[model samples]
Target chain A: MKKICLGVVGIVLTFFSAYAQTPQKDSSTYKSRKLTFDEANLVSSYYKQEGNNAAVTGGIGSQKLSDISNTIDVKFIKWDRKDRKHSFDLEVGLDHYTSASSDQVDLKANSSASHADTRIFPSVSWLIENEKNGTTIGAGLSSSTEFDYQSIGANINFSKKTNNRNGEFTAKAQAFIDKVSLIYPTELRSGGGGDDDDDDDYATTARNSYSGSLSYSQIINQRLQIMFIADLISQKGLLSLPFYRVYFNDNSVQKENLPDTRMKIPLGFRANYFIGDKVILRSFYRYYHDDWGLTAHTVEVEAPVKVTPFFSITPFYRYYKQTAVDYFAPYKTHISSNQYYTSNFDLSAFNSNFYGAGIRLTPPKGVFGIQQLNMLELRYGHYTRTNGLNSDIVSMNLKFK
Target chain B: MKLVKLKPKVNRLAVVAVSAVAILSSCTTVKEYQKNKLNDGEMTLSSRKIQKTESSFQSYREGASGANGGKTGGGCGCN
Candidate 1:
């Protein structure tokens, strides 16, 4: 009887000791250091426009054009030993466009190589975020290529959150070094125009732009948030298109010409408010000015209404107005005595309106029963300008995780 | 005459400054748990991903650009 009791007691003690030695699961301290796939997004859009103002035709011809664009971006995330989060993003975009005005580059030709073109742009970025310090730093490099143009861009950005995490400030600087092909109009070519199909016939000029941006965002309340943004931009080099034809009052035609340097300032504000469980209102406003004697204002509003937790509909509208630049004039309006001149209507005083609607779907299971597909959205917009330009666009986005 | 011309501009600036102060002073310190509505995707204070192409087109068509998280200049949108 005594041996049996001693054995039982020994077994109980062993069980208690083993239980005490086992480790408890604490998720707070366990972060995966390995890089993990975060998400990917694909966006596609088709746009068509019709107008009477075409800069390539001295701002008085068909501005008919159509473009199809697609972009894909993938992101990855990892945790470092210091508990900082690192993110990597890679993006690629392609655009194909056909323009009737560009086809008029050779006035007598029914069709020209400049009528249609394709563009490709790719960018990569890395960001490091320190949770303890509430700070983030990021840098990116981007490039764009087309038959007549090439651009290389670089940017760096930093952001910091307030101690309470209610407000944040960000600053960014960006630069682009671009080369534009000097594809002169056939009649305007100094030497007898070379074959359009020969790339060696064209020379490229440099155009560089630099900008600095600052922004601040704050959570005003549980249902409201706002942001302010400002940017200073400077550009130098050839600012006018080589192929654009400007007709003087005397009926003589020449290529557009303008000053090589410009300075611009733009200030913007954005606000988002949740009206209730079903509706959200987003609004934006901006004021812009440039040293070329251009001033502009823009206002936009959008309201998203949730019909269900997983589905929402959004309606939006925008209004914009701008004053003409000092160098802008209508076709055959410039005189020979003018030192600078352009027939580009985009630089002319005008008002524009854009209205659009969109639908978004995000389901817990998936967008369409595919586990990896997280969200899907579709949108359409119509635009009208006081200068008689009208356009329509349709876009779609798909997100996968 | 110069002061008279600048009067309206000064008034507009003062109004903006006053409104900003009023808005900031009304802010409440919200706890994390009470941020559910503000944390919603639609409530973000920046441009949405779906509006990317729209912004691009607008920038190209308009004389004014930048401060909207879109390209100020580059890549030649010369259609």
Candidate 2:
């Protein structure tokens, strides 16, 4: 009886130790440990031992996706294996983007929904990831036909793994530089200039911005995971839209604009719920305010469900609304005496809606080939503005693990 | 001019209404959404075990889900 009691006591103590110790995220959850080239019939498990994915997207927005009314982009992503200590992962990717937009419009034409610019952009990105300690770092560069922009960013994060992965904290920052071409006809430069050839001057505008976010992610029991993120952003330099135009003939409005330099802060949150074996619910909200005298808000929700082991579908919806800056007005409203003004629709008071759906498919796991090699996704989206502007979108992503 | 003063206030109310609708819709029992034990994770929220890619989510972007995979390694412009 004494021996039995001792054994029970030992067992009880062991359980208490486990419960008292801070729990940790199990490493086995990563695929690196489970996948083997031998398990799958591949040319050779030897190439780079990295995971890769490619996606192409085409979309339209009230104001061109980039400076063009409609845009298309192809993105390539790859993640190299982590170092021995699992201290960090090396990631790399590229984006090839092209945009075509209509030209500047007068009162006789509707210019709010089109872009008159045609250009191609190429961007490169890199990231370093730390899983065991919960942290990440990232950087990127992009070059466009009219401008070449470079960006560098980084983030630090920490989390708890006990009982459940209940909560986490993160901080992030980013900076960018833009070099734009300044070549235009004399008539296009605020009415007239002596030489149209004087446009060859290139302007290297340094617009730097830094954003800091302190976020907390918590698992409120088993069914829900909620995240709250608060951000502070500061921007300086030429932030105005160059091609936007405003008219004042009888003050018939055609466009709107706001100040170029501003600082902004936003508070946002996201919540995710696991409804059942195959269904998931997500919600997002953000409130934005800037020093340039503009305030905006965004809310989005999406529901995703697995129709089968190999197929999944998701439906998404978003609503955005914003108030115009104190200095914003429809063409000719700015008497030129006002320091800030434009007819750009992007700065005007308006609301919009975005609706979309996605379909995803994956071949059987461990099915003699690469685990992620055969996955594919298709997405379609629609956007509309209260003022008579609308757009459609299509995107596809393919992967090879 | 009087009507213009009311527009801003009206929009704020609309934002609140939208949130209410979302919270309420979440409570409804959709027949297609049935609970599954696989999601419960045996009382623990995270499993450190290296898993099948399909079994776990990849939080690979910065806009919402997070920039890194959270131990799920990856490099992407979104990060």
Candidate 3:
């Protein structure tokens, strides 16, 4: 009986010790309160266009232009004491372009200083999201600067999710204050002679814009989602480019003129659907109208086919049509009696088609075997307008984590 | 004659309204666990980052803008 008792005691001790050594369940969820690095994206694009409708030259000159643009954005995230997530995004963009039409601003000079310019834009945004409440608030400030134009922009946005997390509503307000240099065509300049390179020598005019937007997104099912968006935009102050020449029926040339105030409304819808296991279809439609007597319609569609777990190809097409604004006319088609006149073809009635294809690669090991490189995408598009304008653009994006 | 002219427009609008209602009514509540396909990057309802420049140029080249998460009227695109 003594031996049996000892054996039982040993067994009980072993069981107790094993049980005690087993790791206890952690009842508290751990979240890092410190700010953490999230991800970064680098985007680059090259665009070139050729046509004969140059607004600067009274809509009848070389409209060739080429631009190279690059932008980088970095993001960081942190959790506050209230368990709300805060995210910060900083982005900077640069663009350099050479336009054959801008050279005509001098009219008498070849390859003038106005032919090439560079622009830099930078923005910073902060967002706070409450997971428990499924709400987010964000604000951002942005600025853009070039030789003849400067713009400052600000925006605030808020979003809330439905109880079931299947739908979300978002609202945003934005404002921009801009300054445009009153640089006129050489022949039309009152003084007839000024240093083209001295941007400060010219007078500047203010142009301000404000807009309010609302959007709602709903998940139709496990494989499909849709969104509806609408915006009201208002602009006041200088609305026309001073360098854009307008030639009247009598062949008299003057600077383009437009109303000082404009209002616009745009309504849009987007739908995305996943088909089977390998394809996704995305579609968008927009209807736009403005007090300037311009009405437009846009439709876009894209299909992405997944060839592998890590690779996909997307093909897209877009159709856009717009009616001429009240102030718009072709070269030498305007009458001097009109209060507002412009020869800018962009404001004239036209239709355009844009088509493109893109490839994306996201390997498990990372793109190009670099663990930090999360994805790489390359895309090319061709755009053609019915009024004899054609352009091509190539874009690339790289994401790092 | 005027009524006949307006009849087609009314029919078109009615068809659009009915289609939208049908689509919305068919929506099913999807749980988070069943959102694998919905979570795909390509399934996003917004414009892709790669289309930023495209959107910029379009806003400049075309008279119509806004409602696409892009700048409506800010900087001068006079080039």
Candidate 4:
């Protein structure tokens, strides 16, 4: 009986030794759960465009315009005890633009205060992801303010991944409450003499937009993936720019007018395929329709060729075509009989072509030997419309970690 | 002439749809280790970060908006 007890005790000791040899599931080795800085990015762009169609000037003036834009975004991340990941993104943007046609608002001033303007926008977003359930929820708030326009926006998003993690479905809802200051043309203003500094006399109108977007992305194979997106957007309130002048066939000029409510639907598809070890094809197509009798189709394709593991060059082209809205007419083409009329070429039937090339660098040692600078990208694009409009833009991006 | 011009687009769409279905139906359950290509930075199906401003300008300049992962409307592009 004594020998039997000793053997049992030995077995117990053996089991304890095995348990002690096994490594403990220590939480200390896990990633820190406290919020920490993840990365930051800066994007800058210069855009210039010139055309003969300027809506503000009865659609027959110089449409020369230039814009400089800059944006910065920072991201923070944390994890919770339940293994949920939380992320926060903060962004700020600035845009300064000059338009030659705006000077024609007064017709006598070579340069008017409205010729140049600056816009500032800021936004913040938060996302919480539960890895175990493959689901994420997010919310965001944003605002944009400029000389004549101000907007406040909010959005909420939710996404879920398939059981096998090969597919994801996302739904998002957004709303923007905006105010547009009515700055009618000098001749069209209530007062005979218009002063740019006098703002108390200007009236403000509300413009609101709401949209719901749904998308699904699936991995078709190891080297291919595809996504489908659809959006329903509705807008109410002032849809016309007060400064836009529409010339009637009878030589009468009036402020542009349009329906107070608009509804839009856009459907899109995107596909990306790894053609070879070093080349990838990305393609997108979209069909859009609106209540104002506008129908459009857009197609874009880009091919990125990897020069090295950390370097790539992409060339892209986009084709777009649209039918004119029912209320749209060219210069001095609309009749006084039409209740709603606009001379804005933007709403006219037209097609456009845009082509661009971009280069990206993600060096293993970081950009400029700075360990924190992760990547750099530069892109240039040229756009042309069938209606004698053309534009060029150059953009740069810097990513830091 | 318009119908002739549209014929190519319709055919292209049909071809794309067919190929997409075939590719999806023939998909094999890819293991995590085999996802390197799909996970490549350049393989993202969405617009690149460098294209942010491009998308914004396009939305302003073009009559049609949305479906490009860009804002449809809010800010005044009015110069």
Candidate 5:
């Protein structure tokens, strides 16, 4: 009897110790609060286009242009003591473009300063999110600089998720304060010529834009999701470029002129549907209007086919149509008496078509044996406008984690 | 002029209301574990990073802008 009692006691003790060593089912979860690198993305693109209507040359010259652009974005994340998640994003972009039309800005000179230029933009944003409350707030500052223009922009955003966590509402406000340099055509330049310190010939004007955006996204089911976005934008000051020439019916040439203030509203809808295990359909539609008498409709659709869980091929098509703004007219069609007028073909009524295909690869082990290189995507697109403008673009994206 | 402009707004509102009603009625609560399809990279709601330059150029070339995750002014797209 003593031996049996001792054995039972030993078994009980062993069971209790094992249970103690094992984690409890209801224990509080702890997450690391340290900041850590999340991901980085690099995107690069090359674009080229050709047309006959050049606004800079009174809408009657070559509108040939080429641009090469690259951007890099890095993200980091951390958890605060209050258990709120914080995310930081840093991004920088560079674009180099050459325009034959811009060359015409100096009609008297060959290959002038306006022929080619480079622009640099950098921005940083931070967001704090409370997962328990399903709320987030963010702010960002950005700047873009080029030879003839500079802009500083700021934005703040807030988002809230529904109780069920199936829907979210977001609001954002943005402002851009910009300065545009007035460099008149060579022949148009009056007394003071090119000089480093001459404030006489070169002048600058301010252009300010403010916008408020609202959006709502909802998961309709396991396979379908949708979002509605709207923006109200207002702009004031130097709305037209000083070098864009306009030729009137009277055979006289002058710079483009537009109203100082403008208002715009655009509404958009996006929907994504997983058709099955192999295909996903993405669609977007937008309706846009502005006080300048411009109205436009845009529709885009894309279908991505998953060959494997890690690889996808997507094909996309877009159609856009817009009405000519009240102030827009063809070359030499505008009368000198008009208050506001532009020979820029972009403001003229036209339809455009864009089609493209892309391939994405995300290997389970890594991309090209590099564990941190998580994804790669390559895309090509061709765009054509009804007004005899055509362009092609090729882009690539690399994601590292 | 006011009435003419208001007509489009009214029509748009009606369309949105109907879409909202239809979507809400069809919505099924999806749990985290069942979000595999929605969480796919291709299912992201915003524009992709690769399309950044495309969007920029489109905004510059087109008369209409905004609501497309692209710039809404403040650049010298003089080309």
Candidate 6:
């Protein structure tokens, strides 16, 4: 409610400011004098890739794994009479990573590393829309090579954008089905002394989730837009940590066993500011709490400043902190024989900070003798975790009409 | 009744059909829409950054054992 009021006040102030400032266009007023919705682009980039240090762990027995992935994607969009819409997006990609293991708690020491498999994944997307009535429906199917798993999802969205294209309401319901395929068994598992599934080849399970998304987007005049989104999600089936280990008496090791069902709801706010003709301000904040008795807060900020008309540099920063789940323990801290206990740092008490910058360059009109070169983006990221894991990533993307 | 079980699904289908129509309608003016756009040099979606920002969750990528879902592709030993 406060945000809505602020938006209204901002729009009113902007109107007054513009009305009072009787300005004449000098050097900058060269071409267009109006905003046309027809100039809007539906499909932008066809193929893109990005690499960012997705996670980090730094403490005892710590290991670091960073990713470098590249992808090729394409899209086909068509519009029938009466503004009906259909779009198909197909993407294929590969990923490679390096990892290290340690006997001690210090991730930096004895953290020797090894690289593994180049994976291929393909996905197909379908989208149907009716902009006039403010409704959208989308579904997708995708899979990975190594996991031999597939994801099937569908969503329905309802939105109302005001006549001025401001102050919009949107709600979405989505669901997904995921099949688990990743297997776990360290090299030493041949001894049959392994705590978890020494004789089991794989533990397969099906996971399903449903979510509701609600949002209000407002254009606070021409220079600013802000939106708030709330997401409620619930998932069930095999939520275990396949690779994480739990140490018990005499360093007895066990795989993580988690509850079959979990629930989470997150509320977030996003704001975008037209700081200048060539600079933009984007900021977001989210508060999340789950049924597992865990709470978390995340905040992020990004600024993109245009340079030379065809290139822009974006710098971003994020901070995240979460409290431990009820069944989390660092090592042997688990005393109860409960059905759910995990030593995974993902469930343990920890905080992390991610800071990075990226540069995007697009050819100006008529560059490279290509009439429809939409974009080219390059990005990199680095993340640091309290658990002694740090990683880096680099990626690139190309867009074409 | 079976009708009860089908209510949400049917409702979703209707919404999807409507939304699809909305999107298709958008394409009718693509040529016209291409004339007055900003970010014409290249396209940018501020929300897309959210996908990248989501990586900080740790659980999103680490837990999936490499589910590799969504727009971004990654290679990590989180599995």
Best by lDDT: 3
Reference-based TM-score of each model: 0.93, 0.59, 0.91, 0.90, 0.91, 0.68
Q: Judged by TM-score relative to the true structure, which candidate is superior, 2 or 5? A: 5
Provide the overall lDDT of each model, using Cα atoms, as 2-decimal numbers: 0.87, 0.43, 0.89, 0.85, 0.87, 0.53
- Shift of residue B70 alpha carbon in model 6, Å: 6.3
lDDT of 2 by residue, A1-401 (tens): 23433453354334334433333223444444321221010110000001111000001122232211111222222334653222222222222222222222222334422223223333444444555554555555544342223333334433333332345565555444444233222234453222333434334445455556666665554477656666666656545433334454354332223445566667667777777678777777777777756677777777768787677787888787777666655534457555556544444566777787877667676223534344556666666656545555554444333
For candidate 4, what is the lDDT? 0.85
Candidate 4 C-alpha lDDT tens digits along A1-401: 23433443354334333444333222535755777767777787889999998999877899999988877788888888988889999998878889997777777889988888888899999999998899999999999999889999999999999898888999999999999988888888766424577755567899999999999988988988999999999999999988889999999899899999999999999999999799999999999999999999999999999999899999999999999999999898999989999888888899999998999999998787755667999999999999999999999888766
Q: List the residue pairs that clash in candidate 4.
A: none
What ranking emerges by lDDT with the best candidate at the front? 3, 1, 5, 4, 6, 2
Residue B22: error of model 4 in Å? 4.2
Q: Which is superior by TM-score, 2 or 4?
A: 4
- Candidates 1 and 3, the one with greater DockQ: 1
lDDT of 4 at A6: 47
| Candidate 4 lDDT over residue span B5-75, tens digit each | 99998998799789868866876677778999999988877888778878888887777888766676679
Scored against the native two-chain complex, candidate 4 gets a DockQ of: 0.62
| Candidate 4 iRMSD, 1 decimal | 1.2
**Residue-wise lDDT of candidate 6 within B1-79, one digit each (tens)?**
9999999979976995696455334332222233222223322223453233234235542321111122222222243
Docking class of 3: medium
Residue lDDT tens for model 5, A70-97: 7878887888889898999999887888
Scored on chain A only, each candidate's TM-score is 0.92, 0.66, 0.92, 0.92, 0.91, 0.74
Error of 1 at B61 (Å): 0.7
Highest-DockQ candidate: 1
Q: Per-residue alpha-carbon lDDT of model 6 for A14-51, expressed as tens digits?
A: 43344333332223333222311111111111111122
Q: Please give the lDDT score at residue B25 for candidate 3.
A: 89
Runs off by more than 4 Å, candidate 2: A1-102, A105-164, A183-186, A190-201, A249-260, A365-372, B1-79
lDDT computed for candidate 5: 0.87
